[model samples]
Target: MASPITPSTGLGSGLAIGDIVTALVNSDKLAKQTQITTQTKLVTTKLSGIGTLKSALSAFQTLIKPPVGTTSKLQFAGYSATSSDTTKLTVTSDNTAVPGTYSVKINNIATSSSVGTAAFSGGSTSAIPSGALTISQNGNSKSYTIPTGATLASVVKQINADTSTTNISANIITDDKGSRLVLGSTITGAGSEITTTSDITGFTIGKTDKLDATSATSAGYIGSVPASASVTINGLAVTSTSNTLAKTLGGVSLTLLPGSDNSTTTVTVATNTDGLKSSLQSFIDSYNAVVGAVSTVTKATVSDTADATTGSTVTPAALTGDSMPRSILSAIRNELVSTGAGGDLSVLSQLGITTGQSDGKLTLDSTKFQAAMDKGLAGNVQQLFSGTGDGSNGLLARMNAAITPYTQTGGIFDTRTTSLNKQQSDLQDQQAALDLRVTTLTATLTAKYNAMDLIVGQLKASATSITSFFDSLNASKS
Candidate 1:
């Protein structure tokens, strides 16, 4: 009729049942947990390595083949323009400019046409009779309606509101006498002049006259006619509607300064070897950066002492022995050494870019590069690098093509990353399942041990009761 005694510490059974159950559960889960942890770490490290490699490749690609609306540092042909007298005229040249010397004589700079209204006695607030005002410029005319009780300032604002259509703008110029309404044309050419006709009373407009005796106190046009830039290049006369003579010479832009009139200057265009050399050096550096990344990820280190836990003497990188990085490196190296269809300077070695024998990095031979430039092979070098605008011929183009597969969307790197992510997820699931199994096992073992302890306690209790009864009976018999 006695109840069984069950204690977690197992006092009745003389054993630590709780500790035994814990030890058994741990023993069952340790191996599986260890495996899962190791695999997850490896997957995470590999993914990080892949990301680093991809980033390096993308940077290199941007330098060589930049995105749309961006220009690559590598120019097909570079040129510099020098002016004999910068004060007289300044010149700039682009890749399209031909290397040559030109004798430029600037006659006059272009001037904009301007006209002003007679001084108003009422200043900016002077009222004018409401009427229609028409402004004409470059054969285009636009009419503006002057509102009732319009002031000079208000009329100027109204005129300016239609500036885009009329090619004219109005402003209020105030001198010691009074305020005057000034109108100027946005364009400057022989026939592009601002002319206005208005029926508003007290509105008298005339061209500005710089030569008039009282012109200093009156508002008028500065010159008699709209002027254009007059210049002669190499004994040929050239007229431009703007001071900036962009179409006067191929690849050359000349700006006629104020003091440049009646003065002659020489513009010299030459090859820009310095710019080309700098770009070439940048290409070498970027290429080497990619190579360095690959080397780092694929390196294996032999330690002097073995790791205490793993007990391994050789430590390999996450991507060590991985064929992806090695294959990428090999593909790019092939492009660097391969011959191109470009003439004369078809190979990188011709431009002093050579691969290192031991480290696989590019080295620029300054002496060889200068010699090639001195030999007048700069154009050929450019051709080798930039090609003829076609996408298939140059070294940069070929290198871009070679690495596109690995760096593009859903490419090799992406595929590898996806696989690694799935592997990580699967490992996590395995860990979860193992943890669940261990939990279940622990509960089952604990229940069984508790049941056994209860049985032992009951047996001991009955034995003690029987022994006590026997001792009592023996005493009675004695």
Candidate 2:
């Protein structure tokens, strides 16, 4: 028998060999438990990395190989501003925006002018008979009574009605502190000029000449410009009554609005080939960014190469640095540089863009590239990145179509994230069970040790009792 060690210090000699062995075994188990916890975290991170990579790859595939399989198309149109008359509006069919023959209609016309009037004297002078005077025009009538001493202002009031009347409207025009009686025809157009047909008894035109009709009229005109502006559309100079011109050419109609100068307007038409080539270049740029991100996480890393003797694949973690990212980028760069079936340069090199080997970055010779573009080397750059469908095939349209599925109630990303949450919840359940096991094991182990300690104490008392009894018997014999 050995003395057991005190629980606090493990220093007594009453300990069993099994107990020491259990303590050493528990220490090794704890080390393994720590490794398991670290590995669990690594697994979770790898899951997230995989999800992001899938998304990036999906985006890259969609860009590189477009589903529409056709390039984009674009046409131009303009508006006419030759008519000063703002109300001369135009309408079209469909968009009626086509360049065929379209017409405009005029609405709401007007004009203005001034006229002369007579004055009266009081007390029945030679100029007038005094008392009251009547004024009439075009079947309308009004009366004014001349007082014994009527002032110029009083005579003026009779001629200028404060408000509306049947034949014509009358008012006083004032400036600074001075006032002049004015008359205007309520109707529109040049025919609406005001004139006094009848005179009052005491009033006359007088030696003081009447005011000019033009002086009272407004300056601007209401109808469309009498003349039209000349606009040359695709070499066809068109004379339009109004400023707006809608015309069609090559199955597409471009509305030609006379430019602001209203002089010679020049419009340049882009051919279909030019439009398609421009569209293709845009696709290449977008695809490269996404591929680069995915490659960063999927490549081999430094930690993976460590502990190779352990026989495990030692995938310490997925590649996370610049080297792998650039490698993946280079793969995509190689694809773009590969030659197409036709054209002066089969690949992007023909377009004056050369890829660098170290990092897959591109260098553009702008002057040379522009020269190729000018010569139509890109072969309808506009068509490559977009489809010619009416309102259905631009880059935005294609991206929207692809992303629509992910937004649906049961979409892929939604399902995947939900699955991850369920897995994490299950792991939490396992952790709880493990915690209960640990608690129960600690309690049972402590209870067993306490019982063993009590038994050892009992044995020690028994040994002492026996020794004392034997010594007493020997003393008696002596």
Candidate 3:
């Protein structure tokens, strides 16, 4: 069999064969294709709407609910620690910090030891003749041998190179006088004392009480002895190796500012009313958003209707009449208003968060809320939303539990979406099959019409030849 030819246009008998074939195939599949398209469009639209609803619900539940959200850190009250004199000390605290006021007298700030070698004419490049020196701290010692003719910089490097046991840092510091090797303790406090074992006439190398933390570095040996930070808290002595004291008082940390020696500053921690208020407002906003979303999905849509008697249009909500949405919304609304669940501040209304009569959405009265919390309900606010018990026991917890069956993995929405996806895929397959069949039919029609045109042209030529032959014979007889 010959390969079928597809014409450039409707070439068979000039009868627009391609158009006719296309019309036939399209007529055959039109109804079925229309049904599938309509169904897919409706399903997709419904899915989109549900997605919006679910997104809003998930966002609110995850952001505001302590058990289900990152923002659960809101459970811990915020405290602002301020010093009467920030020059003495200004501080920040984590959620663990307990709120209180304490008197702090900084007798002295912590110090680091700064020690150096005696001046040399050549400064940092000056040779540190070959010698073996030992550096000790905290009763542990380590030694390093200087290479012959080592520069002052090279000696500094050798001393600082191995601090695993020496526990001291060395550097070359130079001024107008000359350069010298400076060694400072890696840590602060009396235990961080640095001692050297070496005899060099040009340098004094050893731990000495006379070498304070701020000694001059002009001479061959300038060792600034480290000191522990000392402060008096409530008239009691407190000491720390670091300036920032950790938990010296119950759930409190303090630091001595520079130049606070013999000076006093008071640190006060208190409830951050502004921060708490902002958190509460966030909760209200999330609640409102969820409520609005539910209403959008479930609320009955209204349209105008013609009145039979008065010939006038009357507007009414031709409700979807879907009991599922109504039931879900009604359950949530009832829960919001229901009382006696738990806690003295058991109701959302007590927090000035209440549903509006008209829109069925929630609104927050900031003034009323602030007043309620200020009047001593602040302590119970957490219990009202996030109480201890089963997840459904508290208001916020109830909301979280209610949506879990739909939003969580292997859930209601997941099942519906999966089924819809399969349906869509099946529709696509059917559409592709129809398109292929039409293409095949079109090719068959084109070839058949082309052959028919050739046969018709041949017959017309044969008739013309017969007429010519007959006329020739007639002319001959005449």
Candidate 4:
């Protein structure tokens, strides 16, 4: 902070005036500068610590409360469906599926109906007479105007464009004889069939016609009849328009695969023990992660021996004395240890989750969890974790409620961080004010020192003149 105009050394007084001014300015601002620095460091460190804690809490919240359009992890903890022969069929079940075994026999998988026109001699470039062509399927009919000079490929494109309305698609298949226009329905059922009729010449459209061009009595078109999936579950016959039968069983969906015709398989719905255990373990791990985060932020380290050079042996974390972490842990612990009102598994301990004594983390007893599942307590466990659709009953719900005040917007952590940020901003202002004061003090001290140096120089000049006068008088007397 040395000013360019300030003299490095006084010309008359022979003293370092610039150094003296700078020293005085530094001394005046030292205490306030140190205070601001300390405060700014504290606020920054605390903000970082709070951010870490908030991240941990948010991760835990995401695990408990998933986003919309997603199935909850707890739903998969109850029942699972397995097929004896997956090649023939596969099955999936929800929580509402009953635990039972069923014998399923597949008569045939459903197939869509397809009809092909007789081969034309002009291949894919075959021309057709301009007329209105109507295609009907499942009682839905769509008409297309076949313009003049329309080739087989062009007509196929027009027909396919209206497939959404007709539930039918058209394609051109070329063979050695020529190209044929094939139309197929997008649906599969007993009454779903593709029937094409047009006033165009040489376009014979019928259900029983053959697609071959070499036959003496070749019909204008050939078609394959649509069929539905036929299956028997536990000796009861069931029919579905598609291969996937969802409503056949309550909460159970059966999918028929290829080679399933005349095949039989068994499906067993049972408790998903491994899945439930893994989910519980995940919950335990997430809870422990929060505990670990809190510990990291609040832990204190004390040296075994205090050395004179080191000043102090005790070091505290940013949040060592903060009450927020303690309060958060207390809230979570209260919910974990509380008992539900009405459920077979009222507490988490019943599901093999217990809190640790030394470190407030959760531990899972795998043996006990497996035993609980083996005893058919999966439903009770699910209810315990998820509650009965109420906001306050379930473990997850209660835990969410407990932490909401701290994790929500304008919550405890946010408030603390905002306050700390404001403190940081205030510290910056204080530092700026201190710097300005120092600058002003330096200027004042420099001007006063320069004036004093000038006066001293004048006094020395006067003394030298007086001595010269005395010396001249003494010379005259000699």
Candidate 5:
């Protein structure tokens, strides 16, 4: 097929059969090309959607991610310069602390726990252990089998072994022969009462039978109470319940210990997180999806070929060219891999997302990736994707922002669509003009040919009759 010609080449200067055929073939080619170009533009639009969605996700993730391992560490502003030497500094967190220069030595730090109470002994023989006290809370029940040889420590080991509950400890007060089994509340505001479905046998309930509770009042947060109680801490009259008395004095903050009053304090802090680890994983996921999508567009698969005349299928090799995938890859790489005056920040590799020399595919050193993200990942991620030009910052944001201009009237996409529409309109007008021209040509050719056919047919008829008459005349004359 010949390539389509523009309006300037509509009909050749000289009219001929070859020229007419050429114009038709060229028109078909132009139409196909326009369709392909439009489809490419549409594909770009779809990819923009993918890219923007990813950017939005990245933004949200960047905002909430805690700074490295800082989330796990307890932060207190003020302590007496000589407090470490004078007082015992204890670690409140259960997990082992990371090795670092301590603000104070954690001397004589005791692990947080609850002391369990003694179990009730003896159950009625036919009652199926009914007489023994059963501790029930939140629909979960556990029977205390106080054996003849049962000790408080043995019960504590059993409760600790049960994975269903947390922090259950049992200890004996040997001076009073009173065994106390303490159930530690895994969370704050846990219910106080421990109910029994079975009878309490050989066990006496005392004023201390109730579980010891850690409350907000004991923690010294007096915001709820209006009347100020005078308490002298290090010879300082701390009146307010919520104010940082220690912090006000020489930028020092006090770490308030948990109280045993059973009221949960409003100050609930998050535990330390394994920073950078999770961030690296997310980046990997997004990066892989994009890479895979590009690979799919660039690679080709085998297909059966069709014969031109009979349309029979056969194996045939054909060359196909596609630039969309490569263009997308380029856009992403240019955004991520370029360095700027913002320092040496460029590419995922610098931030620990390395690519191999052989394949040029992204690989992650999780430790490095996490550390970077934890300490300074937000700046790095933004820096990597930021674009060149005055005020066109952040590669993803820049590209997504650029998409709006392409969609506007007379923009690249708009212009192409407009141009294609004009081409189709002009093609239709040309087709209409061709209809008239062909009609005129057909009439003129048909009339001239019909006249010749009619003359030849009549002559043949007359000759046939004349031969017959000649035969008759010959016979008569003879």
Candidate 6:
């Protein structure tokens, strides 16, 4: 491809036309071509570094935000709940819970009503008079027809599977006494009692088989009569139609287990110190991750032994001398150590979260953190990460505010990345144009060298013909 004539082409020109043309063209292209290659790789590396930094910033923001939209668990003053007598009641606490112990006497747990029809002496297939039966619960009712030859089990099955009956469930209990249809309500509130009636004379789901709990065993007793739950929080005698109580304590929920009346229990709600520690630990870990990521991009290093063993030279991060990484570290440090006026717990240091070794990474001192917890997170953990007004004055909020811009669409990272990508595009365009020019110039030079070889071959043939003419003349003279 270099030239039409070559030494291997049997031409007597004695010139390496192909090699000469190629060398000239290559010499003209080497400088600009190398610049394009090196620039492309450098730009790509910078873009990747920016992408990693943005990811770190986004993760730190997620850790700072509320885990759920409903509650600010990250900003909660943690609570621990305990029931002194768990046999009668169980308890749990929520955010904004207060610390207190109160006497709780579960006068009665709410119960759902149930009624059973008169027992049939014959087998479960015993037929009943044709009639209309209506079952009602929780303001919903369903009607069913009792056919002329319907058995006891068929009637029970029909009532149990009716779609219109929302809160009532029916079953046929066939004990030694015989089979009786039992109807119970799904809810325990006062108005949730299940009721039933039938047009057939002397045949209805009535309370004929109600268990007297006071005199019956646990196995024989079933809940009847929809009654409101009764409990005394701090001897205040609160009443509820549901067994689960949430307003009994300032920050706890109490679930009533079935038990006899007149049983007294004690309930306590207090701060969960370990839980508080775990929540704070999240911030420490996330902060450390961001710090490590940024450090790798700004001030990476290697040990002397590793460098010597691997023959690897020291090459700092691309962003090492850039103001962006420096400013990023400085801004986060400012927020981590910043405090509010007259605030109980303002800075991260108050919660025993601190950084060391000239790096922006965070560390939690357990001993100091325990001491802070002893002082109730130096008063309130809520006001620590969330301020007294609007929650914008705390460490978490400030850090979020500082870091949010960097990851947004038009922030510093976006601008810098856009610029780098443009540079990469420009270099690629330059390389393409330069390569086309080199190709064209090489072709032109090869064409010119090929013509020169043809001319030299023609001149050599002319000289050979002249020498033969002289030799023939001398032979004629001899």
Q: Which candidate is the best by TM-score?
A: 1
How well does candidate 4 match the true structure in TM-score terms?
0.73
lDDT of 1 by residue, 225-305 (tens): 688989999999999888898888998999888767789999999987887888888999999999999988989889999
lDDT against the true structure, per candidate, is 0.82, 0.45, 0.68, 0.82, 0.41, 0.74
Model 1: worst 10 consecutive residues (lDDT sum): 207-216
Worst 10 residues of 6 by lDDT: 212-221
Cα error, residue 412 of model 1, in Å, equals: 2.7
Q: Can you give the TM-score per candidate against the true fold?
A: 0.74, 0.44, 0.61, 0.73, 0.35, 0.67
Across residues 63-102, which tens digit of lDDT does each residue of candidate 3 receive? Answer: 6554533446344244556789988876665545656888
lDDT of 6 by residue, 127-172 (tens): 7789898776666678899988988778877876863436667776
What TM-score does prediction 5 earn?
0.35
Residue 341 accuracy (lDDT) in model 4 = 45
Q: Compared with the true structure, what per-residue lDDT tens digits does model 4 show for residues 1-478?
A: 8453434588778778887888888888878888888788788889988998999999898888877888666554488889999999999887677789999999999988877766666877888779988887777778889898999989999988877767788888776656778787768877776777878654556655545556422434444577899999999999999999998987689999978899999999888887888888788888899999899889988898775855778877879999999999999999887885456778888778878889988899988888888777886766777777664688888888888898899999888988998899898888888888888888899999989999988998999999999999999999
Give the residue spans of candidate 5 off by over 4 A: 1-332, 340-346, 350-368, 371-395, 398-409, 432-444
Q: 1-478, model 2: which lDDT tens digit per residue?
A: 8555545532233555356555744664575556546655655765576466556645555554445865322221121122223233322222112233322222212333443333222311213224654444333446667565554455555556533654455444443323334455443333333333223332322222344334322211212212343445445545543343444333323233322333322232333333333433444455545555555565544454446545555354344542533444545554454332323444556556666576454556667667766675543232322334452343334444454444345765466557656766666676676667666666677566657667767877788899999999999999
**Candidate 3 global lDDT:** 0.68
* lDDT value for model 4: 0.82
lDDT of 1: 0.82
Q: Rank by TM-score, highest first.
A: 1, 4, 6, 3, 2, 5
Off by over 4 Å in 4: 1-8, 71-76, 84-88, 98-103, 110-226, 249-251, 257-266, 305-314, 389-392, 454-478
**What is the per-residue lDDT of model 5 for residues 1-478, given as tens digits with 9 covering 90 to 100?**
9544333422322124344554554564566556555555544544444344334333323332324654412121111122332222112322112222223211111122232333322311211222354554435666666455544455456555663563233333322333334454332222323333334342332222443223211111111112222233434444433222344223234333333121112221122223233444455555555566545444455447666744766422111144444554565556456454254455566557775565445677866755664664433343444434552564444444433344335654455446546665665666566556655666655454456556655776789899999999999999
